[model samples]
Target: MEFRLIDRIRERTVLARGDVRLGIGDDAALLVPPAGQELAVAIDTLVEGVHFPHGTPPRDIGWKGLAVNLSDLAAMGATPAWALLALTLPRANAACVDGLADGFAQLAQEHAVALVGGDTTRGPFCLSIVVHGFVPPGQALTRAGARAGDAVFVTGTLGGAAGGLRLVQGRLPFDPADEAHRALRARLDRPTPRVRAGLALRGHASACIDVSDGLLADLGHLCAASGVGAQIDPNALPVPSALRGVFGSAAARELALSGGDDYELCFTVPPADVGAMQAALAAVDGKATRIGTIVEGQGVRALGNEPLAAARGGWDHFGL
Candidate 1:
């Protein structure tokens, strides 16, 4: 049954990339990295109840499983090339396998990522995916390159995913006819990995990271790595009006600062290079907003000189 499920996934996700000297039917994948390019690889494991809710559609589960790893590659300013999926299922349901394969393939095709190899087993439901992408040597973005006086920027609006989670958990009222709620739910279910924005940022951004955790927490990581501080303009956060409508303005802004799962890119660039970076992202249909400035000090704070409280931090796997 596991072998049959693997066959279904292989059939659905077979993309022919020249770099793949040998693909799925073998003991191991033989891949050729593009010359002079640095390979950026990232892996993530999603468990049923922890990463996603019970009863979430299999298709969405598959997409989110891959999207999260792709976001990691995006942070490195890499172009995705291949993926390996290890899925653990409670039961070998063919319909669920098909849905998962179809969803995973859809996004992989969009990014030209081929599924080269993977494994399957019976266990508690989970998906572990590894994605490999390529970036020019010496040009890949990292969290350590930021400098004092660099501008802190982010791609896309925030807070919608938190609202979506709320809706899904029944913590917030959900009206089927309300487009805003529907949109928020969609954001939670299917995040858009900022691949193009990352590509555009190459040679432009000094440091980069994806907002898988809350912005404040991730930006704090960047600051710690670069030996700098950040002062965020609370009003400058791109909180969608739809989110504000559902959660109210104050709560929405809080969510934007501390909510996880947005999957947008948070990056830093020198003040002098801001216009060029903006233009690069614009050319790729990306929306970037400058929300803060990196400073010589040490942590993250609001523009009012008050530090963000530790209680409102990003998601911690161990709940520490």
Candidate 2:
């Protein structure tokens, strides 16, 4: 049964890469990195109900499990190369395995990421993936390079995924068939990793991070790493139409400030280079909204009407 499951996965996802000396069916994967490129690796694990709702589609779970990890690579401005999956199932169910593989392969092929090796076993339902990518030496974006006076920016929209989760939980009322609702749900279920945006920001962004644990939490991390502070203008935040359509301004603002699972890139760029950086990103069809600036302080602070406490709380795995 296990062999059949592995074969089913193998048949579904056959990403080809020349750097892989040996792929699946081996004890381990053999890989060769291109010369002068640094390897960027990221791993994430998702379990039923915690990372996603219990009844979410197996395909979506599979896709999201890999998508979050890829978002990490994207923040580093890396080009994806290979992946390793460790999937645990409640039972050996063929349909679930096939659905999961289809979703994983779909996104892997989109990023040209080769799934080289992995393991599967009977256990609580969980999915873990480790992705490997490459970046040129001294070109990788990091969270420690931010400086005071740098412009703080974010890619794509924010709070849509959190709003979608709220919609799913029935906390936010909306017609399921509404286009905005559907868009929000899609953002939550299958997030688009800002890989191209990150690539374009390479050599331009002083520091970068993917917003996983809400804007405040993740940006706070970047600020701490860079030894600077951030000042955000509440009026300048990019409000997603889906989030605003369902909730009022205050609720939407809270969602945008502290809601988790958005998976958008939050970065800082030197002031002098901001115009060229924004133009480069626009050329790639990446929407970057400047929401704030780095300032000489200790942590993130709000500059407009909203108080600093507005963004003080976010997703904490152990926080009740």
Candidate 3:
């Protein structure tokens, strides 16, 4: 049954790459990195009822399982090349396998990422995915390069995923026929990884990190790594209109500050390079908004906003 499930995945995701000398059929994958390039690899594990809610569809789970890993590679300004998936299921179910494979393949194809090797087992539902990417030497972005005078920016809007989770948990009122509500739900189900924006920022950004654990929390990580601090202007955050409309400005502001799973890129660039960085992202059909500045300190601070308390609180897996 496990072999059959693997066969289904292989059939659903058919991709060809010269670097992938040997793919899914073997016990190990053979890949060759291009010359003058550095390899960037990232892995993420998603467990049922932890990373996602109970009763979530297999397709959405597959997409998110891969999406999260891709976001990690993007944070380093890498171009995705291959993936290996280890999926666990409660039982052998062909329909569930097909749905998961289809969703995973859809995003893999978009990024030209080939599924090289993986494993399957009968256990509590979970997916562990490893992604490999490549970046030019000395061009990869890292969290430790931010300078005290750098400008802090974020790609795309925030809080939609938190809003979607609220709607899913029945904590927020929503109408099935409303497009705004549906959009929020979509944000939670299928997040767009900021690969292009990361690429655009490679030569320009001094530091970069993906907003998986909310902006404030992730920014705190970047600041800590760079030996710097940040001052965020609450009014400058890019809050989605849908979230503000449904949750009101105050609640939406709080959500934008600390909502997790948004999958957007938060980066820091020199003040003089901000214009060039924005133009580069714009050329890639991406948008970046400046919300703060790097400063000399130890952690993140909100500027004259009562929401500093909320900014300090974000998703912590172990409640640490």
TM-score of each: 0.97, 0.95, 0.96
lDDT of 2 by residue, 104-136 (tens): 999999999988888898999998899999999
Query: Which should have the higher lDDT, number 2 or number 3?
Result: 3
**Top model by TM-score, which number?**
1
**Highest lDDT model number:** 1
Candidate 1's displacement at residue 103, Å, is 0.9
Better of 2 and 3 by TM-score: 3
CA lDDT scores, all candidates in order: 0.90, 0.87, 0.88
TM-score of 1: 0.97
Model 2 steric clash pairs: none
State the lDDT at 240 in candidate 1: 84
Taking the tens digit of each residue's C-alpha lDDT, what string does model 3 give over 167-205?
877787657798889888888889899988889998999
For candidate 2, what's the RMSD?
A: 1.8
Whole-model lDDT, candidate 3?
A: 0.88
| Candidates, ranked, lDDT | 1, 3, 2
